[model samples]
Target: MTGEPEGPDFDVPVGLFEDIEDLKAKLARLTAQVEALTGGDGAEPGEASADEGEAAGGEAAADDAEEEEWQYPPFILLLDPPEYDDELRALIEWVEGVLVPGYLAEPSADARWCHLWWEHPVAIARLHAVWLAWQELTDPASCGYTGPSVWHRDHMDPALRELRGSTGPFAGCVKGEHQIDHRMPGLVPSAWTHAED
Candidate 1:
C-alpha cells in the first residue's frame, strides 16, 4: 500500500499561495492607484464590472479567475473598470474620427502607427495615457499651446521610448533612425506578443 498523496504531487514552498495572494492584492492596489491617478476607482483595471463579476455564478467565475492572471490592462480610462465599455466607445470615436483618417500615413514611416495597433493591449494602454494627458494638457487655458509640448515631453516621449525602442514594438522591424517598417497590423513587443514562447 503506497501512501504517495496523489497524481501530481509537487513540492511547493510553505505559505507560497498566501504570498501570491498578497502580491495580487498589492498589484490590485497599485492598479487602483493608477486608475485613481488617471481618474478611476473600485477594482483594478481589466477586471469585470459588477454584472459580469457577480453574474458569473460558479464556472464562469473560475474561468474569469483563470484568465485574470494573464490579461493585460484593459483599454479603459475612467473612475471604474465598469466604465471600460463607455471609454472604449469614446476611444473608438476619437480614433476613427481623428487619429485614423489623418494619421494613417505619416511623413516618415517610422512615425507611422497602424490604426489596427489599437487592437494591441500595449498600444491601447499607452495611447490611453497619451489621450488622457491630451485631454487635460490641451485645455487652451491650462497651458496654452505648450500643453501639447508638455504632454509630448511628459507622457508621449516615455511611451514612445518603450513602444519604439530597439527592443520595443518596432524592434527588429525598425530599419534605421527614421524608417521603421511594419509588415503586420500590430506592433506589440515580442515579449508580450509571443506568449507561446
Candidate 2:
C-alpha cells in the first residue's frame, strides 16, 4: 500500500496453533496419534508387566519353600564291635570272590602283581579283619587305634603304578624322608615279592 513492495503471503496454515501452550497441545495430540498408528499402548518401553512379575515371584517363592523342606540324615559307619565284624567278613568275601581273580589274570603279570603289593584287595580284607579282631580284643575306651586312625590315610591302599610315580602312599613312605616300618615286621606277610626289592 504505502509505495511498499506488496509481496504475496507464502506462509501456509499449519493448523490451529495460537500460543506456545496451544502449540504444545497440538504437538502432544500428534504424538499420541503417531503412537497409536505405530502400535504403542502407553506402556513402559522394556519393562515386564505386573502379571509377569507376580508369576516370577511365585516361582521364586516355590523354589525357596522346596529348598527349606529338604532334610539329610546323619551317616553311621561303625556302630558296635559285632556289626563291625559282620561287615568286615562280608567285605572280605566280596574281595576274594571278585578282586583276587582279576588281579591274577591281568597281562604284564609281574609288574601288575608287584604293583598290587601297595594295594591288594586280599590284603585290604585282611587288614579290615585284623582291625575288627583288634577292636574285639582291646578295650574300646583304651584302644590307641580308636575312631578312624585304624583306617587312616597311611593304612589305606596305595594307587596303581605307585613305583613309577611319586603320588601314591607307598612313594611317600619309601621315596620320601619318612621312616616307615611294618609294625609286626615278619608277622605281616608280603603278598607280591619282586626279585629287586
Candidate 3:
C-alpha cells in the first residue's frame, strides 16, 4: 500500500549543484561583459528590448525576441583573439579544474600531452568540441538520465584518445616540455614544382 516510487535512489554527484550555480554566475557575468562591450543597455539576457506601448508592445516584443536571443558562438579556433579570449579562458578553467584532475590519466609516452596545449590549434579545437559536448550532455534538462554516461562514452573518451594519444597534436611535446616551434606538417608543395624539373 506504500506509494513511494520503487526505483533505486539516484545520488546526485557531489558538488554538482555548486558547479551548476557557479556556471550560472559565470554566464551572467559574461553576458554583462558582452553587453557592455557591444553597447547594449544592460537588459537581462533573453529579455526583449523595445518600447512598451499599449498598441506596439506585442509586435515589438516578438521582433526583439528573435533579434536579441543570445547564442553562444561555435568554433573558437575560427574566432579572433578578442572574440575567443573569454571562451578560451572558460575552457581552460574547466580543463584545469575538472577535466584534467577528474578524467585524465597520467601523461606518458603512450598518453602524450603538452603543458601548452593552447599553443596547438588542433588540440584547442578538439578540446573546445569536447567542452561543448560536455556542457550539453551533462545538463539533465537537455539530456535524459544517461547524460553523463553518454558524455563520457561518446564525447570525453573519443576526445581524450584523439588529443592524448601517441600520435596526437601533442606528439611533439611532453608533460614538462613544450616545443616552442611545433607546427602541423605543411601542405605539399605545388604539383607544378616538379613539372619544371
Candidate 2 local lDDT, residue 101: 57
Prediction 3 TM-score vs. true: 0.59
- lDDT of the candidates, in the order given: 0.57, 0.40, 0.72
Model 2 misplaced regions, further than 4 Å: 1-79, 104-197
- Highest-scoring model, lDDT: 3
* TM per candidate: 0.39, 0.22, 0.59
Ranked by TM-score from best down, the candidates are 3, 1, 2
Please provide, for model 1 over 33-110, each residue's C-alpha lDDT reduced to its tens digit, 9 standing for 90 to 100. 365345454655555444453444455455556656663344364336557767766777776786557544442335
Off by over 4 Å in 3: 1-68, 183-197
Candidate 1, superposed: residue stretches over 4 Å from native: 1-82, 101-112, 157-161, 164-166, 170-197
**Cα lDDT of model 3 by residue, 83-150, tens digit:** 79988999999988898899777899988878778878888898899899888888886687799999
Clashes of each: 2, 0, 0
Q: What is the lDDT of residue 86 in candidate 2?
A: 62
